[model samples]
Every structure is written in structure tokens, then in C-alpha cells.
Target chain A: MPDTLSEATRSEFDRDTSVRLREPGVHDADLSPGWAIGHALNGGYLLAVLGRALGKTLPHPDPFTVTAHYLSATAAGPAVVRSETARAGRTLSTGTASLFQTGADGEEAERIRVLATYGDLGALGDDVRTSAKPPIMPPREQCFSAQDYPAGPDATPEISKRLDLRLDPATCGWAVGAPSGRGEMRGWLGLADGRDADPLSLLMAVDALPPTAFELGLSGWVPTVELTVHVRARPAPGPLRVCVTTANLAGGFLEEDVQIWDSADRLVTQSRQLARAKLD
Target chain B: MPDTLSEATRSEFDRDTSVRLREPGVHDADLSPGWAIGHALNGGYLLAVLGRALGKTLPHPDPFTVTAHYLSATAAGPAVVRSETARAGRTLSTGTASLFQTGADGEEAERIRVLATYGDLGALGDDVRTSAKPPIMPPREQCFSAQDYPAGPDATPEISKRLDLRLDPATCGWAVGAPSGRGEMRGWLGLADGRDADPLSLLMAVDALPPTAFELGLSGWVPTVELTVHVRARPAPGPLRVCVTTANLAGGFLEEDVQIWDSADRLVTQSRQLARAKLD
Candidate 1:
């Protein structure tokens, strides 16, 4: 595992998301299996990849908003990230990226497509006005660690192990014999590799939990068909707070809205994702 | 006005969104001043324009989800929508489109870029599960029509005149001398043209209202920096109920989350948009 990289090497995230310029608006990156659910890559991790590529392609330094559409299931391997800058201004730069993996027949398949706007989080200003309350979660010590219920390699998603995720006992009843039908999940999320959470890392933190529908007596790897992320503020170098709530599941389509509050007690990101599900 | 087009002419929406294929993956459509805020086109109308183009380029018929990033302020005139298919499956197809308008430099400048997933709405089975409550509002007749507070061209947007939108009296206080300071806007939206509301038109309906922050006692047209639309169901042929709420206004950036319910009392669209609001 890349977790034990020497101090001379980059952090697990910086290393995994690092990309090389192949040409203008194109880069080469490897889809690290460690950041995936089985052979399927994590949607947030994919966004992080595109974010990194976009961060490089555009003049802005931080990814302010990202909307990704998972066109097809991805395999863990080498992939090409193609980026394009649509608009570059002083405060905000908008761009798009597509991740492509070549198949055995020599055909390049696009796995994920993204549209993002980048800006300096430092310039986002301190004018915060919010009417919504943050999720109420116990200290990280009180909540049970997701590692408590470790499924085998075939079951437990690798992405979960790469992050220190603790779930609210009230919402994790589904993990045990009893299931809660609330369709909500709250937790404290931190990189298991000890990588400090940033706007880019927050991308991985948003989708780093089991589907909220699991509490509704549904069990399976819920794949995200599409995800939209709004990065409001920069994280304050520590484990962040996370809450995932699913309000609707119609026609086997479920929408999960997530909120991430950094350790400083600031809401850094708000995301809503649409995923397909099978009612049992 | 084209509102009274003869029976042979297409409806205002159908005519405005109709696109002509210029070549493979390219389309030509004129931006109508009627579907705009002053000179800037409405964000949702821009999405519908791209939706119409995507609807033609992709194999599927209906757009299930659309995410648009407004790169620059778009001017009403002749523009081209360029689309590319990323994937086409049996159930869903994904594609991207860019609306480009030629500037005085004779350069084709990209204005709005979109990523959308299309599917057959007819195949979306009737399995709806939602814990969220639809907005409660009085009957349309009981509510005050937006036309009641109409302003001159420089004051009221042209879009308001083209749509028979009715506002909840409780929230429209900002339009008058009194400001509500609740950061919420509830209204019933329908085309003045009486073009029956469908899935495509619902795109325009999602963003047809003034910024919810107007109730916060702010003025000026709020420009949407980014928008994401989730189409879960088809319309039931009537004025759609719309409720927009702004939770946080941080650094002059306000997040407006919207819910649109059709006449059948089903949630047809859920959208979240990030717009820049300069506080007075």
C-alpha cells in the first residue's frame, strides 16, 4: 500500500491524485485501486482526479464547484484525464475534464465527465450567512468506527479503509441486526493516511460512506449516477464532520444530500447526488 | 409578440428551444430575448436550450439530469450548441453541450457549458419514496400574481412577462416596501403562452423566480454561477408549484435550493444553484 510512503514521497492523496501533462489540456494519471469500491472507483475520488487536473489546467488554485456525471463503471488502472478551460477570469475559472480508460480492443472509453469552477478559497471572503444548522455528532471517540464492521475484501469497499470514518450509532443500526428506516447517516471523516483535509480532499470525504438508503433495509453498493459538489470554504487541517441524508427514492432512483463541516465548525461543502437503487 | 402564434406555429417554448442540426454533434438555435433577465439569458432557459440540443444529439428522448456552468454572460442572438455523446446505454445516455455565441471579434465564445443524462421518462417506473414534504401554498388564485408588481423593462425582467408566475404573498413582501428577511420565495410558475408544462419546460420553471435573497432586503439581479437540475418525474399539465430557499449566504455567495412539484403533487425537479450576491 502507498500508505507507508517515506517522508520524501508525497502524501497518499497528493501521490494518488498526481497527474502528468501529456499535452495541452490532457494529462496521464493512474486510477489508484486503493481509492475505490472493489473494481469500481469512488465518485468523489474521480472528482478529485478531475479536480486535480482542472486545478492544473485552469489558473485558479481551488475547486469551488464540481458536477460529475458517471457515464460508465470504471476499472482500476491507468487512465487519461483530458481537461479544457472554458473561461478564466481573475476570481473564477470554469473548465471541464473527462477520464478515459482504454479497453482491451484498443478503444478509449470515457468513464467520468466533469464540469467545474475554480477559485481561490482564500478570496471567498469571511461573509458567512447560514440559516441551516450543522449536524449534531458526538466526539470522534464516542462514535463507533466503520472499521468495527469490516467486511471481507470482496465486500468492504477499499475507499472506506483509506479513510477513518466513524458512524453515528443511532444511524448505523443497519450495520447490525436492527435497521433504522430514517435514511440518514452522520459521521466524523478523516483520511486514514493522516492527509490533512482540503477542498480537494473534501471531495473524497463527501461520498466516503455507505449509501444512506442502507438504513432503509436496503443493502448493496449504491452507485452514484451523478454528483454535484459545492465547496464553500477551505478545511482547517483536521478530521471533518459529515452528514448524509436521503429524502427521496422514487422509481429506484435515490437522491442523497451531504453536508461536510470542517473541524473549525464551518460548512465547507454541500453536495447532492442522484444514484440508482433496486428496491427489495 | 409570438405569444398569439397561429395554430400552425409552434408554441413559444417549443419554438424558442427548437434547434437545427448544423453538422454532426453541432446545433444552431437563436437565443430569445423573451427568456432572459434584461440582456442576460435565464440560466434554466439556457439549460433548456442545451437540453433541446442534447435531446436531439443523444439517443434518449428525455433529460433526466442536467448540470450547467455559466462561463460568461450570454447575449441574445444566434448561437450554436455543440454536443458530444459520452455513453449511450439501454436505459440511460450521457452527453455534454456547449452554447457558443460569436462576439464582435468574429470569435465563437462559449457561454454556457452543460452535462446531461437522458432517459426515457416513460420507463421511469412509478415507485416514489420521499420523506421530504412538498411546499404548502394557497391556491394559485388566492396568491398574488407577479404581474401585480410589474416594473418597467429596466426594472422587471422580460422573463416575468412571458411566464404567468404567481408569488406567495407571504414571501413577496420584498417586492413592496416591506422586506421579509426570511430568505425564501414560493410561487406557482407557468408559461403565459399556456404551453402545457412538460419535462423540457420544467427546466425553465426551476429557475424562473427572483433570488430568494430579495426577501433578505437585497436588490439587483442575482446571476447564477452554477446550476444542477434533477428531473425525477414528468409534469402533470398545469402550473407547477415552486419553492426556493436560501440556506447560507457566505462571502457574497448564496445557495438557492429549489423544489418543483407538478399538478399531480409529485416532485418533478430538485435543483441547487450557487449564485453571487453582493450584500448592500
Candidate 2:
């Protein structure tokens, strides 16, 4: 038998260079929506970090999918994140996090829950089919940055570092530019600056497609009302394909379905979102 | 000045045929599988009654689209169903229901929630583009009935249902011939029961199309995993057209997307479902 080390003798920090640890925070500017008030961290921002944290927990480190449902919001104030492992099945793992924001009077203000699942690379098979194919879009190299757009000029430092994207004429590929051995695309993803890949980071990569799919003349911002993603398996170390299709848009809402396939033409995950599309 | 009726003089329940009520223990069946434990009411039955309830609550009763989700089973015990108006906005109206069955412990065993919304019709335009074309199945008039394939030796109620279908050789019009209009079918459908021309009832008529889409072998039990329907607008009180595409089946599940179009090629509603396909 190999020699065993005592608890105090072993270092708590990870020694391997390939492994990473993440830190999440709530900034001051995250508030001001005024719907639930006094809190600085918005649901959208927390949602972004949740996706990043989930992606970081995957075995082979491939970003597959993330989805969140707004159950009920805590009142409005300062908050902390609480995560619990729900189930650790053989092939699938699920993690749940509840955002507990604290109020000025030292009471719980608002609460939000997130459920995310991770899996290994072996879950997909050879058969892959989709009714709607990804339409051609601007080249990844030529696509404009979110800062170039008039909506959120301040999105650069946060959004730009979050995803390293590669766009063909049709699909956008974003992740840390790594080779996912499964023949699928892979890259560095989630909040850049080495933050945990959480729900918001997943949405940032997922939402990047719709805006770029149009010709240069369409001017509008389609904010999502709800986004639901189902991942069949987790990613390995490479490029993941994200394909999006618009189901139907009527009145003030439009539904879009995005399918994220691995390099080997295997289905990894899929997402469906309904957005409120309006002229900016 | 307008006169208002006193509470003592005003009526609560409708004496006329303004609403249709379905009492508990109406359509109980023990043959339901594990996923659907309680009695499996006809999909059309629920659609018809729910539509009528909406018509009575709205201002003009001009709703055209109604969608249902999570088409699963309730508990195996006491059964109860109640529907009430949640909120009514200018362009949209919302309603909800609590459906469940009682348990052996004298309490509500399982409960399901149904949320529906209604919207006014959109302006008709000629650009009618739909995913559905005419089906390849047989036409309606020349289909065969139960007499064509007598259950012969295997004469269970389930066998009789399989034998009693009227199928068109071309479009494969498979239907369980019930005079109540609550049966499965393939091929083209015309309103033979002559029910009121309302959005809800029309949607019910469209939802039952899956089981009949194929011969489905000898099993009388076709289980729906989940169903979602969206109607753009209500059609005139006339015949409608529907085309279905059984896209794919995997992991013990099959999915079909149906497009309901009015005679002149206007999209009426889109319906789809994931179901457990059985050959027993």
C-alpha cells in the first residue's frame, strides 16, 4: 500500500495547472430595475454565474447546456448563494442553487433556485437529426462585438472576456479554444476573468447566435422571457456546435430552439427560449 | 344612470346551456399504465369542456388559441377538478385548474395544474406559409370499419378497439369510432359531431390526432408524454385542414408535430406531443 498523508500535511489548494477554482460576487450596479428593489445583484447576473459554476463542475470540461425557471423572488437586499448536490446518478449529475439575497433589516429579501445537470462524453450515439438547420450568418472573425451595438456599450469588459467565439458563415463557436477530442468544436466559455461558468454565461453564449443570424439591416433587441435547455450529456475537451431555429413569433413573443451538438455529430444538449422581440 | 342588481336577486349558476360541467368518476379506467396511474380521460373530452368554460368567462367568447402542457397522470385516489378565471387582460385572458384523484388515505393523491391563455384573432393575410401540406393518408369517405377486421379470436375490449377503427387506405384514417367525438384518428378530419364552433373545442378536435396517425399495431393504449398546442386564430365555422409529420422516435418515445390550417390555407393552430409508443 502507498503511504497515506495526514490532513494537515496535505495542501487544500489544487496543485495541477489544468484545474481551476472559481469565485462569484454581487456588484453594486446590478440593481436599479426597481421591480423587487434594494438589492444589487439582478436575477440575470446571478443566472449568468450559475451557468458558469455548473459548466466548471463537469467531468471533461465541455459546456453543454443550462436552464433556469423563476420560481419566486426573495424580497430585495443583500444575498448569498447556496448550492446543494441534488442527485449523483451514474451517468448524470444534478446541482441546485438558491440565491438568498439579504435585506437592510438583516432579513431574507429575495430567493431564486437553479437546477443544472452534467454528464460524461459517452452518452451520445452516431444518429443525429434536426428538422431546422442553422442558417448562415456573419463570419466569426467579422462579427461585431456587443459593444459595437447601441444597447449595452458597457458590455465589453464583461461580455467580451466571457466567450472566445469562432463563427462560420452560419454557426457561432465559443469556448476556450481547445480541441474537444470527440471531433466536436470546443473553446473557453463562461464569464471570462476565470469566474465559474454559470447560467448567465451559458445564456451569453446561447444568445449570441440570434442577433448575428440576421442581415445587417434588421435593428432590434429580442429579450428572452423564458429559456429552457436540455442537455443529453456533458462536453469533453473541444468545440461544441450550437444551432438555433426560430419556432414562431407572434404578438410580442417569439420562440427559438437551439440544438448544441458535439464534434462527432452526437447530440449533447438543446435549448428553447421565448423572447419579447421589439425595436430598440 | 345604469341600474345594478342586488346580490340577493342576482343568479350564480347558469340555468341555460352556457357551461358544460363534468363530475368526478365520469370516465374512469383501470387500464392506464404506470406513468398515467389514474383514469385516462379522452384528450378531446377535456379540451371540449375547458373551451366552453373559457367562452363563458370572456367578454365576446372569440378566443382562437388554447395550449396545454405536461399531459401526464394524476393520483389513483379521489378525483376532483375545478376551473376558475385567474386574470383577464385586454388582449389576453388566463384561466387555471386543479385536477387530481383521491388516495387510499382519504386525501388528494396526485394533482396537476392546467394554465391556458386566449387571444383575439389576427388580421388575415394571404402569405399563408405553413409546414404542413396535405397528408399522404387515405381520404375520409372510403375508409373501412370494425366489420372489416373482426377481432376474431382475441376479443378483449382492447382488441375490439383495434378492430373497430375506420381507416382510409391512402391517408390511413385510423379512428376509434365513438359518437362522442372522443377518439383517435389518422387521415383527414371533418366535424361530424357538430359541436359549437369555438376555439377550445376546435383545439380538442386537433389534439386527438396522434394515436390514429398510424395503425399502431394491437395496443389500444396510446400514452402521451406531453402535448403543446398553439393556435394563431380561430377559424370560421367550417371545415379545417390538418397535416401531421411523425418526425422521430428514440429512447422509448415518439414525437409528432401537427399543423392545423383552415380551408383557404390559413394557420389555425400548431400541436405536438411526445408519446410512449406501444405494440402490445
Which candidate comes out best when scored by DockQ? 1
Off by over 4 Å in 2: A1-161, A164-208, A211-218, A223-237, A247-253, A269-280, B1-39, B47-79, B82-90, B93-96, B122-186, B211-222, B246-248, B276-280
Q: Which ten residues in a row have the lowest lDDT in candidate 1 chain B?
A: B1-10
A130-234, model 1: which lDDT tens digit per residue? 887879878889897755774533566778778888888888888775778887999988888888899898877788888898997788778888999999998
Identify the runs in model 1 with alpha carbons over 4 angstroms from their true place: A1-9, A150-155, B1-9, B150-155
Per-model DockQ against the true two-chain complex = 0.83, 0.09
CA lDDT of each prediction against the hidden true structure: 0.85, 0.41
| Shift in Å, residue A131, candidate 2 | 8.0
Q: Write the per-residue lDDT of candidate 1 for residues B1-280, one digit (tens) a residue.
A: 2322254667778887878887889989888898878778898888898998888889999888899999888888899999999899999999999999999999999999999899988898898878888898888998877547745335677887788888999988887868798889999889988888888888888889888989988887788889989889888998889999988888878889999988888888899999989788
Provide the clashing-pair count of each candidate structure.
1, 43
- Among incorrect, acceptable, medium and high, the docking class of model 1 is high
